[model samples]
Target: MDIFEKVKEIVSEKLHISPERITLESNFKKDFEADSIDLFELVMTMEEAFDVELDDDAVVGIETVADVVHYLQEKM
Candidate 1:
């Protein structure tokens, strides 16, 4: 699957939410109600899935699904 699809899958699995509900504009904290720990776990999942090192500072700027997708795309 592509990075966007993989991201949606990871977010859906971690947040226990449907993939359809996770849109580009959906904010991790506001839309999915993810806390700091949730975000951290999500980042770790992405790191493992993509085999890349995502810095804590970069993760901090990820607010929406689009943000994560864009970041992963750039990193990859």
Candidate 2:
């Protein structure tokens, strides 16, 4: 799967939501109602899935699904 699809899958599983509900513009806090713990867990899961290390500073700026996809794309 592409980065976006993979991200949606991860987010879906982590948040217990349908992948269809996720979009590039979806915000973790506003859209998913995800708190810091949720975002942290999602980031950890993404790190494992994509095999990339993400610094806390880098992760802080990733508020949207598109941000995660772009970060992974740039990292990879």
> What's each prediction's clash count?
0, 0
RMSD of each: 0.6, 0.6
Worst 10 residues of 1 by lDDT: 53-62
User: What is the C-alpha lDDT profile of model 1 across 5-43, one tens digit per residue?
Assistant: 899999999999999998889999999999999999999
lDDT of 2 by residue, 1-38 (tens): 89999999999999998988899999999999999999
Query: Positional deviation of 62 in candidate 2, in angstroms?
Result: 0.9
Winning candidate number (lDDT): 2
TM-score (C-alpha) between model 1 and the true structure: 0.96
| Cα-based lDDT at residue 40, candidate 1 | 93
Candidate 1 clashing pairs, residues 3+ apart or interchain: none
